[model samples]
Target: MKSHIYITRHGESQWNVECKVQGITDTPLTSKGIEQAHELAKKIKESGIKIDEILHSPLSRAADTAKIIAEENGLPLTLEPRLVEQNFGEYEGHEWKKYPGVFHEAKKQFACDYNGGESMLRLGQRIYNLLDELKVRSEKENKTFLLVTHGGIARMIHSYFNSETNEEFSSTNTGNCEIKEYVF
Candidate 1:
């Protein structure tokens, strides 16, 4: 059988509950986030997709969620620094709603670095590179990987697999613990 790549966003974090922009700011998961991880694990197991390995961001929220899934599925996991969420710099910990204009403007200017954070182009380069490498490795080794990451990273992962419009790429975000698959 052909190999595939599976991607999932981490469960909700305390920052998420308070409507803060998580970016690369590490935060702990909420109680509901813990439950959601378990639920995601059950869903994956029931779907019967054999995950050969789990690659997770080192951020606590994503790491914790991936650990749960790894435990449930009896799969090994590796930390992937490239899978970490894009750093939002000045926007970190701020409510997204209040700063909609900044984000919207940043979306159009792909090179905008948010005064210190990774530019969209930079994020795309790393994410696309990671996916390209994974695709090659998956085909050569016949291994499937599950990437546990954050919402910003999730958007990039989807773009790696799909030809997304600029609008879609700018606006897309995955739900907490939502699993997405890409065939190799």
Candidate 2:
């Protein structure tokens, strides 16, 4: 690809403000989050990234952020099912403090599904596949992409682009609307 692919976590959501676990929970963005998206669009313009397409998670937080960016950049948005956050099942809506070591332990156990949620291995499969597909698409079309997704999904994308320790993968929490560039 002539240009790099980019990624960003959706702006702050209601759950994010409350510090709750929001795996696949359709949490909406707050007023400040809307402002953040607007600011992100400005930053993108200044960066001169020239993204060809904007892809976003189906979740409202990500979708809405993508809408703002796309409108500013004059690019079409695509709903990427593969970008969905890892389903945390019973952990949803609860504060992360309530879980204590649950998340850390669960992440280490790639096969564990959080009693009803998706396993890390499964999350890796979908995210890695999407990255591969994005690389091929970028090369075939000579285009760049911007992926709007959640923090959990961003961790997987980071792993796809770099070698990471288990600690790094489990501990990562991307800043809201901060853009990260990657090459294919």
What lDDT tens digits, residue by residue, belong to model 2 across residues 1-184? 1558899999999999998888988999999899999999999888887889999999999999999999987989999999989998777887768768776666777788888999889999999999988898898888889999998889888888889888878887689999899887
Candidate 2 residue runs with Cα over 4 Å from true position: 1-3
Taking all chains together, each candidate's TM-score versus the true structure is 0.95, 0.95
Cα lDDT listed for each candidate: 0.90, 0.89
lDDT of 1 by residue, 8-125 (tens): 9999899999988889999999999999999999998998988999999999999999999999989999999999999987778878777766675566578888889898899999
The model with the greatest lDDT is: 1
In model 1, which range of ten residues has the least summed lDDT? Answer: 100-109
Q: Please report the TM-score between candidate 2 and the true structure.
A: 0.95
Supply every candidate's count of residue pairs whose N, Cα or C atoms clash at under 3 angstroms. 0, 0
Model 2 clash tally, residue pairs: 0
Clashing pairs in 1: none
